[model samples]
Target: MNKLLLGIILGLLAGVVAAIAIPRHHDTASANATATPSGRPAAPHDQVVRLGKPETATQGSATLRPVGAATIEATAHDPHGGPDWAVRVYRGERVLTPRMRQQGTDGVIGHLKCAQLGRIHDGRFGWLDARGTFRPTPPQWGTSSVVCSTPNAAAPLIGTLSPITDPDASAARVRSTIVWGMAGPDARTVRIKVSNISATTQRATPHHAFLMALPARFGQHDVHVGVVYNNGHTASGPANTDRITLVARAPDPNGGLPYGLVTAPSIVPGGAARGETCLFGGGVRVVGDRAGAVDYRRDVLSELEVNGGGGCGSDAQALRKMTCLPGIASGTGDTASEGGDTGGTGRVARRTQRSRTTITMRCAPGVDRVTLQTPRDVRTLVLSPTAHAALAVYDGQFTTGGIRWTAHFQDGHTKSGAVPDVGF
Candidate 1:
């Protein structure tokens, strides 16, 4: 998977080329054609509407009543070229922006504000909802305030994107809806539907999923390099300084369609031949020398869509589980984990969920295996470090429930395991 942060590096290159490139195409039809190769019809813009204000508290089918939620549904066309599309709901400023490709890697990762996303110390599946909302939190003074300065802290999950519709065309149209109602007294959800979108499809395992996180930062820690099998025995290989590699067979027992997600560089022109359920979800753990130097915060924004638009990849569903080793304190947790070394460099600051501390780590180039622990959540695990050094979290316990899990490596190895740790 091409690191979304790489887009920033590319964006920088775009500026250099923009001056010498041919004139921009002004034909809407031509541009639309380039954006939508799937032959799907575009949904009307009116389909995008806000449902209503959320109620303070309301009963639902479950014990936890929704305090606030919004439902938005609409359809929109894929004006750009891509294979898939996703509606990303973000409460703070945009992380991956179009202009990012022009900036340096540091500038790109800076936008993510990885510090505020929460803690890997807990060892639970920590992440900003791909579609969520947040409210502002009281500003902390000094680094603290800088770490948690989200604009709409109260309703953070405010942005969303349509799903990837087709894989055969250069681009596919999409329709999607975003819903929010997790925090606060008023429970509501937002639903927005879009249409006529095209997205790319490739063979991905763990790394492809990590690319979606965008603007990643590697903490100053020892990168734990090893081969993780589904059986639960991780062979500590050499510490990965460049990119860690994992190769597992496709989900299909017969190896059809390379049934998993991969990077854009790995995909063929015709797309996978079979096994279309491959999906990714996981995180990384780094062991660093300094703990205080480590920062675990992140702010996912609305800009920097893939292929110059918006969308992510998907594949087979798998179970996921995370253990929090309190004893473990390697600054190597994902940007969301305990602090470590900062990967890129920049001052593009964005806020996160109110009160949430933002830890911005440097974006590394590697593969993150996403473990499917439950139907409601997914955990992405990184196989290596971006800088080819050692840094990671340590003394952490894990919490897992009822779910089956699998691990695929770059060397064509595979393993399976039951979710670990029922109670944390």
Candidate 2:
């Protein structure tokens, strides 16, 4: 009975061992079944296969491929270094948004949408550089296909030239302010090309205007402007398209004196000339031709009357009264004239004059001071705050020959310009 029991126990142990060994052999076969015949591990079910390295797009170049009715694959490059790029899908110049990303080259852009892409059947792509600048690609028509486009190749349009008075007459130059009426869609910068002139072209970008100064020669000049886009495309106006003719006027032979004074007018004209003089310190004087004598006298009087109630008028009256003397003139023209009298023992002088009228006036608002530099001497005038005219009329005797003027503004800006050819 003991031998039979031991035999039963050994048989059960053998059955358990065989059952485990058979399953282990089948498990090995199952594991091996998953491998290739060469014994290499098989790839994962979710693994992505890479084709190869992508080609870099040139600056301003765009490549687009339609993936679906509303989606597209796109790529672009920056010629000016590796700039992060964005894609803009377009039908003509109209842009659409909601961009997407897909696996592509390092700088390649992908996945843009234009719901009307297939409906329009004609569309284009625009590549935006890292700098937030964009240039459109050429239009692509027809069904799904690879579309490649470049930046706009057309030149920018140049507009009319506006003449600007030369700031410095002594500099012997003229200025022309040009505007870009139609800068092409791709133009990033505008340039003015001035040639066939003796002056060196001076260019400045002030505000949004393009300003240029060229020497004021005696003849005609060839002038044109150009523009350059971010994509390195450039366009210029037709050569010699704009003609600028500068007429040189001879300097005042009389040295800015309209007429010679035989006898100086009274510092203060006592009777009828109450408001004839500019009470604001500078007085009017009549010297040579008197064609506008009555009108000029009337204007001066009107100015004094209108400004008389203001602080400007009070100040002028006070200045004239302080400088005026009885019978004795202190300065030429109306320099010493005023409405009120300076307390003195002598009687006031009265005189009748003709031929020329010289009036000294104040500057316009924003002018702090004005300096007139001439061949003979320099004259400086500190302007009043209330002055509001750009040009100041001075006594006819003030010489304007070879005059260069510098106007200092209240805001610390200075404008220096040549005196008008016609004496001021």
Per lDDT, the best of the predicted structures is: 2
TM-score between candidate 2 and the true structure: 0.18
Off by over 4 Å in 1: 1-26, 32-37, 41-64, 68-244, 248-257, 261-424
In terms of lDDT, the poorest run of 10 residues in model 2 is 301-310
* After superposition, candidate 2 runs with Cα above 4 Å error: 1-365, 389-400
lDDT of 1 at 160: 23
Q: How would you encode candidate 1's per-residue C-alpha lDDT over 220-263 as one tens digit per residue?
A: 11122222334343332111112222222122111111111111
lDDT of each: 0.23, 0.30
In terms of lDDT, model 1 sits at 0.23
Following a full C-alpha superposition, what root-mean-square deviation does model 2 have from the true structure?
Answer: 34.9
Question: Could you tell me which 10 consecutive residues in candidate 1 have the lowest summed lDDT?
Answer: 302-311
